[model samples]
Target: MSLHPMCGVFVLLSICLISFTTPCYGGNILVFPVDGSHWINMKVLVEELHARGHNITVVRSSNSWYIAEKSPLYTSFTVQIKENLEEFFGKYLKNHLKMEREGASALTFLKLTKDFISMVSEGHFLWCEAISEIFDDPNRVKSLIDAQYDLVLTDPAVSAGVVLAKYLKLPLVLNVRWIPSGEGHFAVAPSPLSYIPVPGSGLTDKMDFMQRIKNLFFHSIIVLQQKFVVGPHYNALCDKYIEGGCDVFSLLQEADIWLFRSDFVFDFPRPTMPNIVYIGGFQCKPAQPLPADLEQFVQSAGEHGVIIMTLGTLVNALPAEVAEEIASVFAKMPQKVIWRHKGERPSTLGNNTLIVDWMPQKDLLGHPQTKVFVAHGGTNGVQEAIYHGVPVLGIPLFFDQYDNLLRLQERGAGKIILLADVNSQTFEQALKEVLHQESYRQNIERLSRLHRDQPIAPMDRAVFWVEYVMRHKGAPHLCTEAYKMPWYSYYCVDVMVFLLSAAAVLLLSTLAIFRFLCCSRKRKTKDKQH
Candidate 1:
């Protein structure tokens, strides 16, 4: 007998209930993202796992640190002092304020104070402190461990969670937003810039005296911040949250799996660990239909097409000299340009160009009229362009931007322009080459196809690994035994390596011995003859 639709739905519900209620592969999964953006994709992933009958828990910190939001407190003298002082130098300083409110005045302050900004900006410390409190609170850690979560997934920023995971003996998968490094070239501070290749490769390059000194210097900065700043703050929060005296190197060694958000497409010749996985371009998803107004903007740009100029989330707003160079380029461009400027529209905005403080980036790139993406060469943005088969004119600002742009060029997907040289002529010419060149389009399309054809979506792959650990009771197999060994033992070359070295040494010794005996005998024979 054929079942009614309602009956089928009922049966499906029954099956789902049984699946979720019944014993599943493993325990609950906990996720910690630095903020909304860092954990955005992972949040979606955990939700998917939950729908599939796996349990999930997300521990998020408040967006800010404050005791209360009431008017009485808001107007209190102490509150105002905190706000004003914090606003002057805090992460909630003008740039972040401008980001939230899109205020012109704040943007002006942001540009002027850009160089003077310190890493200790209030918001950065506040959020980190908040997350640390949650992770290090013995009660919270006990509760998480008690929940019997088999796995912990976190970004490198949340190293406190790493310590918690270790205490709980749970497996870890690092969603590395940046390159994982100890005191080395590829590693940059907060972590060691150990991974970048220079005189040597990978960890070997780390042997350079200058590089090690730099690593130690940068590492010391992290240690000092933790000791003087994070340690005191953490101690005040809870006695159990004592700084373990862990550094970036310790954290790197602890991560069971290092999932790089960058791909070999960008970070090549990277000094990688055994567990490192390149799952970059993970945000490469299919396009959605553009909004009618936005679609119209793309269409109005004509057959010559438009150039998309973006400086990414961090540096979209720049100082006046940089801003003027961008404005000058817009004035000279023949095709329409959609520039994502966070500040006031410059006076040099050309008639053909439309300068909006923001654009739906993915939608812009997917459109037919987008020819070249002028970008800061952020890994995420670069991946987005490739995902849409859009070539780029990369003007790298700092950090890994240069490396990312260099790889894009190597892949034949775009051109790189240093920020110093981002004048009208260079910008115009680079735009022309990327837009007009057949090779760039072909290369980007090829990259897009490769990006699309990955064995699994990076998010899905990430989820599977997370859940796999949960199901297999920490998947101890997937984790490294490095922590089980001392640093000297871990670095000591194995038997095969030692044997190869020993054999070479013995061969050289024998040759020397033979030569010495021959020389001695020759000297004696010469003396007797004389």
Candidate 2:
């Protein structure tokens, strides 16, 4: 009878634990996502949210590149766009690559800056226009207001999501790495220019005097760009729709939680906020079995191991010459190579290499036989490499790609070969170094161990916060009110000024008293002598 009672108690405890541990409650969530490679990151979260039984509705552009109008993951809400940016993006990337390859002359630098500003300004305006169209339609506005969503989940790289969340007055959650201004931290946390490098400055955390100056210059440019190039469009939207006008940066700060996509393993240690959840490698999971044919190819590598290369989703292939050079270098190697190239086939491609439109990147990285990963230094690729303990041989193309690789290089986990500096000789040499060096693998594996040592998986932690926001409606207590303070107040400049004035007044008063006492003593001594 005693044993039976104990067993019943154990069973009851188990049931209660199971109920609390899993996601059992369903809430309605509205997600506004950015298009392009960013959608890939957002989709992972959406899928996880759906599996937990939350009803999801995604707002998408009519000509969205990666997002499908129809999906099993979520119901799609399509909005019209003035232009599909694919053509614009393709041309812009090609031109940018051409300029970069031309070298870092003053003229080249100016042109690149001009092109970048144009892209940023135009992209934001188009999104603002799309959102404006949505607001203009009474039925659409009524539908959204009636939805009674638990929260608005969005990626803030584009301000559409941020602005929409503000308009809806829903509890906001951000899937963020970059905002329209620059890196997300600049808008939310304390980032000292001396140590915290500005994105695209290509400087690391440790900097000499000149490097610090460069970091500051880049930071200024980003500020100017946000104020002049990107801010006006969103500011207009806010003025028109919001009861009180808001700025993009302010709205981002108001978010209940920020699912930061980076961690110390792949990024420099910087000041982070309480609401900022570091879910760096949340998208990564253990490798699954490769497709039968792909596995056969990987297995054939045997002693030499395999090399996997992909330039991410944006570019189809390198310029023909660059592609040919990279292909030729691969040909000379004994290791089998898998290159994801979507453009014209390179004539120099070797029998050892397999060219495909896409490969199972995370799976390939996790494969034990995989020796080296050649990548574009994208955030996804870098984080995946860390998860799989694969040493990277990075060829950075554009936009923070170099910065991402630099982090790995600094830690001795990877090496970077600038796209402008690539040739068969240099490419082959870098490849050989990464392949033969054991330290690279050892260092990355160390990172992998550290990343995995956490008590809870990053994905579970991410889901918890999302649900926490749903349950609580918002997490205002965790957020700092620092964003609302004026620059002088935030920096304590006014306090410093007041303290200095008080010290000056005290010093002057003491000096006057000392002079008065000396004069009095002289007069008394003269009278005594008389």
Taking the candidates one at a time, how many backbone clashes does each contain? 17, 0
Instruction: Please list all clashing residue pairs in model 2, or write none if there are none.
Output: none
Instruction: Give the lDDT of residue 139 in candidate 2.
Output: 96
Query: Compared with the true structure, what per-residue lDDT tens digits does model 1 show for residues 187-269?
Result: 32122345343311212223477766665565565455556644443334334443455443454455666666766544445
Q: Best candidate per TM-score, number?
A: 2
Error of 2 at 178 (Å): 0.5
Task: State the C-alpha lDDT per candidate.
Answer: 0.61, 0.92
Candidate 2 Cα misplacement greater than 4 A, ranges:
1-23, 519-530
Clashes of 2: 0
Number of the top-ranking candidate, with lDDT as the measure: 2
Off by over 4 Å in 1: 1-27, 36-56, 64-148, 179-248, 269-274, 482-530
